[model samples]
Target: MLKKVRTVLDDVLDIERILGKISQDKANPRDIIGLNESLKCIPKLKELLHLEDIKKLNSAADSFADTAPVVELISEKLNEEVPAQLQQGHVFREGINKELDELRKLASGGKQWIAEMQESEREKTGISKLKVGFNKVFGYYLEISKIHQDKVPETYIRKQTLVNAERYITAELKEYEEKILSAEEDIMAIESELFAECCQKILDRADLIQINAKLLNRLDVLTTFAHLAIQKKYCKPALVSDAVLDIKDGRHPVVENLLPASDRFVGNDLKMNVDKSQIHLITGPNMAGKSTYLRQVGLIVLMAQVGCYVPAKKATIGMVDRLFTRVGASDNLAGGESTFLVEMIEAANILNNATAQSLILLDEIGRGTATFDGLSLAWAITEYLHNHKAVAARTLFATHYHELTELEHTLERLQNHHAAVKEFGDQIVFLKKIMPGPGDKSYGIHVARMAGLPGSIISRAKDILNHHLEESMDQSGTSISPEASKQLSMFEQQEAKFKKDLDEVDVDSMTPIQALQKLDELKKKHGL
Candidate 1:
């Protein structure tokens, strides 16, 4: 459809200046030619629009007033081959104006008249080689060889003397020059007047042409988006009044398009409502697609809202009054703000302005600062977005702070989701699939190794990580309250005793019944 439209409208020239000229009544044959070229396609495009079932598209096409009259008048009056500049004549039809037709005949026939005179003079003077010539200094002259100087007619007035010939103009020749020049001047003046009259006919219907022009632009965009949807296999999202956003098999359109043909993007699902899953606390390691998932949801919502098909298998969007996204990081050095400062400013704006009807997308908030500080900020922000009534917006928060996932048990509206990963020895593969539940580890060191970090650096980092793990688990990435200290000590003692007993059990000598009895005793002891 788009290809047919482009082929049909290929003759339509840019009529921006023509439109301006029509308003001022200063349009020339060239501008009218451009205007006619554009308006003539209206009927053809209208025929194409009839093939579409969309009511808006058909109505816009139907709004085109009968512009055939304007196109006909311009086509009839303007010559098939018209000069771009208005002052050059031969722009109008011969019979349109009597005076213009007469002057045109005189101007056009001047060359033949000059040729006849050259032949007549050569015969009368017996100068067989005489030729007619013209130049800026001498308007028109008969050039006679010096050998025929004696035969030159007394009626000839000398104009110029060349090395090989003598240039002379007769009285008839001088008089004809003035008349032909006057005819050309009159021809240009009449053409300008005639061109203006034709332009006036179009200006009378300017409003209708402007309406059709706007309609064509609207149709062009619609058809292009239609083509894009068909090629990309997009779905028409179902927009509703409630505050629920459910998308199935959603993929990021841009990422999908940019991926190499051999690789396929993994699709993910998202469901959000004010009820149970308003805020999704997404956790995963670096290089996972948590940020991509956040942006994909934002883009899908925006696309659906703007009447474009969303890149998903199915989508049901509850119209959001406001959508806020802060997905990536960049420092505005000229503005004297670091990346973390900018992140905070954006977070502040979302916190202060977002409503229950808004959709918020945030990625790796507070990740630029110290780990504990960043984790604390991330945790509190999630709690605020979930608990505050004014800011209880549907949100997708992607972060690497795994400790924040504990909020799933605390906040009713916040759900824990992570980009799933698979591990094999020291290497891990990012599945790029968002799944329910908290991620066990960030795999920061594993990601660093994958990034081509030095082996020594990776080994030292792992050593430091193990040292931190052995020191005290609670004090590492998450804080424990003083109130839970006794509970932690008792649990730690129970684990120690359970390990000691499990070590003492000799599997080689124990029978199946003995093993069952030993596990029951250990469970009771561990409970104590």
Candidate 2:
């Protein structure tokens, strides 16, 4: 394979050669030369592919056709080097058209005669400041300074007057102008016709040219894959028929290359199957490699399917038909959509489209809305993926909602993982490693402190968090202290009695005065 690739690389011309030739108006001598050189290599490329060792190259080479006729035609007509503008002439080789050559000679001779006429007019008019100039609007003119305008002859017809000069055209000058301009136009017209003919000949064989170009493109891509594999020490992944993905020590391909030598990326293992661990619920504090882990798994699967080596010690990838990712959020304010609305829309797209053989990576799903709403949506999404009758797609869900970790106990196919971290008093060290089991705490306050939040804000946040936890525990009937549990129980009894009294009241049938009297009595009895 390497030998075959090297042979093609040596024979193929750069694609830029033919790209310029493809355009009708812009094709020039350089383009034709490039096309000719490229066409010369096609036959040689086909012969090289026929060699016994070149298996993959044979199929692509068979599709290429010989375009030597077009090459010969262009070579026979175009000059060695043509100017950028076709009107300037020399666009075609000598003898390609006799009339074009004669017109070119006439235009050249007229330019020399005009120069001599300028000198003769100055002498005859006796105006030392007189000069000749040409413009598109007025083909040619003789100019005299305002101070010397009185010296103008009656034979010079005034064409235009400027602030400080007078311009005129003589009979001799006008006749010369017609001849010169006509010859120049004729030369350009003929050259355009001839060049168009050359381009048409090339376009006639367009199919053959396109096929060869495609073969060269495939060869270039294969060579690039070979180079990247050698440089990055990538290994071929084992593709299996079963719906399972197991990678031992997989590294994020792009991230690992971008890190400095001293802070090399820490590789992690990913093992998931549709039957046992279809959904991986990852929990961790901010910036703890959860997003990176999810992305790397998706990328590795994609790379393997496209016939490229993966960045892992070993990998066995099951075939996945589709891949979906809902990774980030941003509001489209102009379209009247908030960040949360956008997040929901993307989530909806994934749930509606993903199949059992699809791989999904959802990072911080439902995070753009209120806490409970976001958590509920995230929880429900996980449930749907786990229990969907027909499609149980492989999913990697990363979220800060630690409440989701409870799903593992009830969900048969759900498993829990966390980005491991170690704490030293107020300081925390992110291990950047994925491990089994859910995280006990998100350490949001610690993460906030690391982000440089004010100490007062961090302290107050901790207090609020503690208060919330206590309230949650008390509500769940799991209070730690006896006194608190008794207080809550008493409050519940009073709440129940108040509801019972309200339920027994017959205020609708009573008169206004009686109703007021009953309300006062109930308020007094309840110690209102």
Best by lDDT: 1
Q: Give the TM-score of candidate 2.
A: 0.79
Off by over 4 Å in 1: 1-35, 51-61, 73-204, 467-528
Q: For residues 309-392, could you state the per-residue lDDT of candidate 2 as single tens digits?
A: 989889999999999998977899999999999889988999899998999999999889899999999999999999995568
Model 2: residues with Cα > 4 Å off, grouped in runs: 1-52, 58-63, 79-91, 108-110, 123-129, 146-152, 162-165, 260-262, 331-336, 477-528
Name the lDDT value of residue 200 in candidate 1. 73
Residue 353 Cα positional deviation in candidate 1, in Å, after optimal superposition: 2.8
- Model 1: lDDT to the true structure: 0.84
